[model samples]
Target chain A: MNDMHLCVVNITFLGKGPYTFSVGKGECVGLTGKSGIGKTQLFRAITDLIPAEGEILLDGRASASFSPTQWRSKVTMVPADSSWWYDRAGDHFPVKHKTSLLRESCMLLGLEPEVLDWQVSRLSTGERQRLALLRALQNNPTVLLLDEPSSGLDAYHTGLMEKYIGNYLRQNNPAVVWVSHDPEQLKRVASREFRMEQHRLYQIK
Target chain B: MDVIALTGVDLGLAASLLLLLSVLSVMLSLGLERKIIFFGCRMTAQLLLIGLVLRFLFASGSLLLVLLMSTIMLLAAGREVQARQKRKIIGLSGYLISVCAMFVSSFSVTVLALVVIIQVKPWYTPQYAIPLLGMLLGNTMTGIALALDRMTDQLHGRRGEVEQRLLLGQSWQEASSDIRRDCMRTGMMPIINSMAAAGLVSLPGMMTGQILGGTPPVEAVKYQILIMFLIAAGTGFGVVSAIWMSGLHLFDARHRLRLEILKSDKV
Candidate 1:
């Protein structure tokens, strides 16, 4: 819950316009757009995951001021299609967050701690999605970029994730940009909402 | 002892074996007849051209001439490395990286062997330098090409894994460490295997050539060992350098995984 604010000014990517926006600490901004519309690109640009032209300031400091890794450490993204490199699901978690913190995260997501011991290939799509979010959250990021995070989840786990994320935002107070196609999910989770169309962002709520 | 020289007729007589292979290929409808004839002609022409060039190079013994020849060899080797890759990077950077990495590794290893190990007077002597450099460049080229191919293909296949690691606050180097290691191993594996099988499974070509040229068997064996060791070092260094350079080039300043830079063409 540090003094953090993500201000994105004149961000342009993939022929998208000079969109300007900001999310204050403890604020969640919902972004909705047509499937191919550039919601993911915007998140990528904000998180420095791809090349873009813009000034992204966190706590009044420009993104370029910090190293790419440094900036990314502060701003974490949970991609919709999560990728697992290691055989066991547990191997993906950073060693420092392995035992107690990881078990707590699993509990929050309604995941069994034993699931970590299972092979990644055997995990269901829903399990992979939940684990992906947990992997990012455990890092204690200052900014969260959630790209269709609930896509693969059923209603039960989706509700659990929503509650978990709400509590996480309250405790961590990070600036969050949540990209979701579901309007109802946005209404329940986001304080403000924006719609992307024609490569531009419009603040709808 | 003087080595026996083969006459043109003798070479043609030996070439008749290839003609027999081509005839057999045609009879069996194996579709290898054309390739056999084509490569047979190409190999003869290429070796003759090199023989002419080496004759002139040895007589002149100019450092400038030796370097020019070396550069040509290096460029050709670089092109081979690029062409061998299944997924090639877009633009000239890919070709430049291969050339630069090969130049650094092969030239340095060749020079070290000539100046330090062999102690050939006037280390740039074309007879010693060109052959040594040629061997190093040939082996290093294969190593670099294999490594580069593996790296680009792996990165393309595992883009998600790599970006996931990047998203987890890992540096690009940390993200790509696995791919890099895999590439290095790929590049170095061939040389390691050849070294392992050198005297046991087969007499190395260079050693057999030296023996044919009337070198004492023990002397030929010593030179073969030196050449093997030199090739291993050259290939190892070249692969590592190529992988390192590729790692830097593949990622942008913002640490974005620019997979677009790669153009995939199945070859």
Candidate 2:
């Protein structure tokens, strides 16, 4: 359909089962699976982080058409445990995104504008996770690949994160592939749901 | 001034000094006693064999013989570089890259000095060519080894950071820019320090040997200066080429970090 923003057809990686799926604009497709059932690998393969064998399309264009960096810019992933190379938390961001948009994203995600000034080592896991979301958002990605974006957050911060992501989806109309272990969170955020089992993706009603 | 030739008796006196040191190491319960004696014997044997070979090389005076000797030296240096790395790239590419880097840097610099700078007669004269190549190879080998060792270790230790950058839409070069710069600095550090410390902190081995051989002190110092500059340039080029090649090898065609290709050494 013309509304399709991200599409995966028979993708397979690490000798796992071939996975086939697609997500439309403004749709959050939540994936739930047991630990080590290839959920993260699936996300990696979709984003071309790892080698995979299958066709992945973004906005009716094959991923192979763009360079890896170009493709990833449009389909960014917020990993569960983010890493920081620079000392200051703000230095990790691209300069163009360090403007007011970053400040606004931080406030919406229940983070302070001053958090950017803090040393990366001093930031708590929750703060790092939230900043990682902001980092992904700054790319203006057309499709988001989220792996446990709120795993480090408490209930209150989780609500704020969910609201921030929801607002982002409504405004940008990006297709999101969210992998979460919490069924309740999936039910609240995802309109179409799927569960990963033995590397295969199954759509759930 | 006539140079004093070292005789067997003189060398025997030096051997007694080593024996005394080894005995002292044993008496002090130092673990280096056996290593000292073993390495001393190994050094003697290796030097004697090379002396005989060099004599024959110089007598034969053929360009083919000189090239053969140079190739052998390059191979030995390549093996030394490979052995020094704790984590090495899998397959022959690792060996090839090291050898190629040394060959490009050391050989070219040695030839340039012989032909243009020093203007030595016959250019490939073993007396001048072999020693110069040997020094360049030795220094360049160490620089390459240090660079590659630091590179693999840093890449493995910072895997999470590298992948995060990749997911954030960075090219392989952009993701690895800091690591490349760090490795280059590590490789170049020793030569830079040695150059800084030369003449003041310690007498360089070549200048000391030349002076001991009864060459004018000022002449020996001039030669030492040339050799030092040559070694620095060789090491610089070798390290840069090796690091650049290794950097390219770190990522796959699609710009993914294929850390799997590096085989970790068993400590």
Candidate 3:
């Protein structure tokens, strides 16, 4: 767990705009902000979906040195809206181990294995979000970047997400960076948290 | 009635039938119903005007006039290609290259085959050269435009996936192979369709004309076979060259697909 250091060295948004934080390995860091405060943009930038001017270091290696694909595989992101091109869930997680992981994840999130074969187009917003979380975890990424993972979920589903994520963190000790507006959810899943306001990150006790 | 007299009247009647057929085609396929009437009208007018000019050029029997007409044909083909491809092709280079290559190859084949092989006197005669050139150039222009447009659109649409492939250690060619294959398939479809229906479903224009001009049925069939082969060859070459030339400009030095360059606001 303490074998590596995951460093987000310096990420600047819109030429000095909001919410940049660095988290170490085996730590769960939560980001909170009002809507439209550039939290999503920051997630996209970190994932290299949007261009950013800074350095991201994992195990002391600069992120720019790694190609976008390699960087993404190493540090995976589950966006707020998990849009997928393929219709089948099996298409996303093909391996048996991955399917098992997803099934377990679904059970924890109160989803059924039947949902795996269901067409993604038919999945509700909550179902898609839960499936996205499972897909992200299936990759066994070094650093997981999640943007509002439980936003669309009901209270029951939200509790399931927290339980699964909490178990995963305790068992795997992988670095998790979560973005959410809900304080209770943050208190449950996050070991440390910060608030983004007016292009700045303020540490929240 | 004399056999020769009957033959002459038959020719006139056939010409009238062709004229009527063309008008009916325009009305049915286009008319005022389709919003793309402008393209149809332009095609009709261009074909008629070219036919009139070609008639005079053939009668005059001058090499200079034939050359002038050929140049005009190339220019029109170039402009049509450019107009259809608007933003997909960034500079004038793709248009110029495609048109020039199509003109050179098709014209060369027509001249060498018609003059040297068939031994037609006044090798630069418009009667033989103009119609052949028009067919080849028209198909090539269409093929090039489709290839360029499809390639550009696919590259832009799949930018994320392409970049992901690149980051996964795929080279530029490897990353773009799928898109390139798709574009090539799109570009070659018309030629393939025409080839499929060459003899059975429709009598090609050249063959029908040759038969109307009193050439033997066997001779007309031979010319049709030769011309069809030539057109397919010309179109294939044009599509490959256009795709190759345009594809070079689509990527940056880093081998990444350039999104800004390929972006079409209109699309």
Candidate 4:
């Protein structure tokens, strides 16, 4: 693990435990848990979407000092069921001048550059999932909180997503906390692993 | 033109028309017999009560009384506004929001009209103040209620979409901007539709009343035009205020979308 950017300092989520964890720059921290164990709720809390106690820090700065906008930008969360409000996928992303990086991201994910032009309604679940990930990456977030990012993908597409995400990770050096059920994917992607069981935090590896 | 007065017999004849409606409901088996009878009685009682109260207020000619009357009207409107919402804000915020918004819109507009536009003898004369406020407050209340209703429902129903934008580095304002604008527009629809259809479809209530009371055609038209504009202004301001303030309630200091501010929407 490189220099730590994302640190969860005794963050307690609804009697779930004073959760203590950290993800270093360029490291993907994978979390596995049984369904209904409040994984999504924890993401929301970290995003400050729900009210929770305990201090979260980014690069040695306290969560309290940072405005919600600044905090969310630094610690962007990609939800499992990604939301698309616009007619076209391109509208969801920020207006940017750099196309080369975006195009490279598309190519890495096996998507054509014109995929951004397609309407959200026309995109398949796999396509939407990948695009949602790409959209979040475009924001240049410092800490990427991914919730089951590749859950909907088949083996081939999942591989492409993992590959593209891995590429983005290396380039950006962002701290990542990924929630996934697949152990094999965890083994491939995560350097450190933790299992959430019965409201208790256990570090497996 | 001489103003015509309705005698007691004439009033009795109007009351008899309601009996005919009750008979029709019974014959049609529409299950509206109880509702029709109750509505007729309620209308009679409400009209009598408002008429007596206005009469006493106007006779006394007290500014405090006029203000008190306006407050009572605003509070009643606030309760109605609270009742209309499908997704209500918990406890006092709902009442506070609607009442404050309507008070700002209706009271301000009524004062401006009385002092500047109409230039009545006294600014708070009950004769001018009560009727004008009644009309303005009624419209403003509906507008505020509709805006609040639509906004709450939208926020609750489409949580995922809103949270997505926020997660993508948009502020709470940017994330919910579309829904807010759309809700305000929806709130103002009744007033806009009324204005559009006023001339072509049917005579509005104020105009029709003036005409029947033997006001000249042009005179009635003038009064109706002024009233409509007043309503439009009041409703517009009221809708804008409620929806914008409710946005504050929806998002916390952390800029999180707190649908839990609503009483029913736990998810």
Candidate 5:
């Protein structure tokens, strides 16, 4: 991909916090850090979920000007522990193609189709995490913010997640800001990486 | 019919109704699955205690007693708003402003319209003044609380999206427009629903009481209309004032959300 296809963006938090680097158009950019180093803050800042000091541009258009609903619809964040407001996964998926996406995502995440009808309260941590990813993708967001997407998954499910994410990135070309603490997972999917430390982001080659 | 002789029975029935209402409130709370039994119990006890105090004051029929009771009501309303707010409101200014606004507007309107316009003698009569003031104050208090709660929640919850809008070159007013609208709507929903349901779903208290007191149905309807209008006006003013005052509380001199204000342990 050309450099112009994926523009560089600077995301700063609070008025004086350190700036974080973001890159991608349809690429997967892995963001790794120890807990509480502002990784989630960075995601929120980039998606315009929180107040920040820096500039984020998509295709050379500054993201600062877009309305929140527009920005969120375009660039979505899927939190690690997704809280459900509905009882069943089916209830949460409102779109027509939702079932198809759930089926495809379930196949990718090693989840069964029957899981969709299960009560959200009954779903295990791994299942919910997988379901959250599927839900986030349902909006066809231009940029995906994944906050520890595999935190609750077993090794088998984690492997499925890695494959699914890799293939999805290749097909969709939607940029990703994937946050993870797992080194092996990072190496498996991330084409570019940035490690957060001391509130500053350092690009990892 | 010698109805005046049944004053003792009337008092007893009113007391029993109050007790029944308290029980109904408890059952409603349970049905709603709220874990607020303690809060509900405290509110019931406080209201009953206030009722006893007011009964004594009414019997005395002193202007000084009426004024003291009104002051107490205002203070209690203020404290209730503050407690319900979870102390997310900054400083004492918002609570004070809300109390003052609700008190002055509602009290003046009730006194002037009910007493002066209608020419009810003994204008300081607790039976007339206290109940009217109580209705206005109670509704206003709830309106202010709802407005403040909704405004604060929207501002905090959508902070990120708001900042992004600002970055995208929207003015602060434009960026926070959604929050403002949503907060106002949320705060006003109850009043709107009540207005819609009035005279249909149930007979409102003022109208029912007026009818029981032997007022003609047509005359009772007029009073109900006036009371409902006054409530809507009181609620509107209370909500607007609370939201405007809360806007002042939300941002600091630096224009950042004073997040520390939201961290009260009182709730």
Candidate 6:
């Protein structure tokens, strides 16, 4: 673990008030909100994937100091509906890292190893969601942003993901901000929890 | 040798032949009678108007007048480009982009043709420059417009996919490489097809006109070839430039896709 910490300053985006928070290395923060409360927008703003005015710091370094590519690679997001551009699932993963625990990741999500060789269009939503997270984990991101990551998974797969993510955080020590609708799931995975009210996040647990 | 001139009565006699065709269309119930009559009237009016203005323009031969005509053509072409896009950016950005592309492409190609290729003594001679510029601008405008429109639509349509790549450490350039290539291909394809089909399926307009005006067949064919090559160059460059410049503008220094840069409307 690098003792890295993800710090966010007053991020005022999408008519949401200035948001301030910090997630330390090996720590996971759970974010819960109703539909369209600008939860995903917050993640986008933090990742600099969209336009916003604010400051985000990773390992005490301002996002401005990193190139867009470097910054995004450091702060990776696994969107609720994972996007697949290529024909086969394996094509989306970088060739150098394609086999890096690729089978293990599939197993962690209760998927077959052959899922990687399958066409993207043939994958179930749950498969796509798990693969999307595995892809992010493969990049060794400093900050992992998950937006309803387990929304498509059933209870069994979600539990598996929870176990995998917990072990991943303990091993890599990257800051994780997980957005989930299930209260029980939050209690299981998050070190701290926050609830959204009026387009802002408030610490609840 | 001078080509024979037609009297007004002679033209009317020729026009009557078109009327007979329209009458045949009506009898056949081809449903093209109104379109035939409308197109015939419009063509006559449009050609006569151009003939009158071109007579003045040719006689005056003022460089400033030629430039003014050129700017007007560019603006009209830009507006046409803006109007044709189904998913256009909102604001004057479309106009700015379309005109910028036209200026960057057609201007350079026209200058290259006049100075380097033709070496027309006065280079800016309206007699040579204006007609040549008109052809280049019109073709280049269509190509650029197609590319810009297609690229914009795709970027917006595939917003999720592109943003996802951006989130996964890809820069705007990498994220959009496929869409940009596809758009440029769409833009350049029409001209490439037209070039392939030019002489075999139908005689191109300029060649037909030259042959009708008593130029030798070989000379007309040669001129047509030159025009086709020039058009290909101008259109290819224009479409590429338009897509690249506009694509650059659509994103920020942070490599974030700036949808806000585009305005939507009927132009």
- The residue ranges of model 5 lying beyond 4 angstroms of the native Cα positions read A1-10, B1-80, B91-131, B142-261, B265-267
Tens-digit per-residue lDDT, B1-267, candidate 2: 667888999998999998899889889989787898899999999999999999999999899999999999999999899899999998998898899999999999999999999999999999999999999999999999999999988999998899889888899899999998999999989999999999999899999989988999999999999999999999999999998898888898899988888997776
Candidate 4 or 2, higher TM-score: 2
RMSD of 5: 8.9
What is the TM-score, restricted to chain A, for candidate 6? 0.94
Q: Cα deviation of B184 in candidate 3 (Å)?
A: 4.7
Candidate 6 lDDT, A3-73, residue by residue in tens: 54998877888788577788988899999889888889889999998767777888888899999999988
Off by over 4 Å in 2: A1-3, B7-13, B16-34
Q: What DockQ score does model 4 reach against the true complex?
A: 0.82
Best by DockQ: 2
Model 1 Cα lDDT, one tens digit per residue, A105-204 = 7888989978898999999998999998888876789999999999988889899999999999999899898999889999999999988876567799
Candidate 1: pairs in clash: none
**For candidate 4, what's the RMSD?**
2.2
**Model 1 interface DockQ:** 0.77
Candidate 3 clashes between residue pairs 3 or more apart in a chain or in different chains: A18-A199
lDDT preference between candidates 1 and 2, better one: 2
Could you give me the TM-score of model 6 versus the true structure? 0.91
Q: How does candidate 1 score on lDDT? A: 0.90
Give the candidate number with the greatest TM-score.
Answer: 2
Q: What TM value does chain A in model 1 reach? A: 0.95
**TM-score of chain A, every prediction, order shown:** 0.95, 0.96, 0.90, 0.94, 0.90, 0.94
Q: Per-model C-alpha lDDT, please?
A: 0.90, 0.91, 0.73, 0.87, 0.72, 0.86
Stretches off by above 4 angstroms in model 1 are A1-4, A95-98, B23-31
Q: After superposition, how far is residue A7 of candidate 3 from its true place, in Å?
A: 3.1
| Local accuracy of candidate 3 as per-residue lDDT tens digits, A44-124 | 667665566777678778877886556766677777766554568666552455566667678888988789888888899
- Model 6 chain A: weakest 10-residue lDDT segment is A92-101
Better of 1 and 5 by DockQ: 1
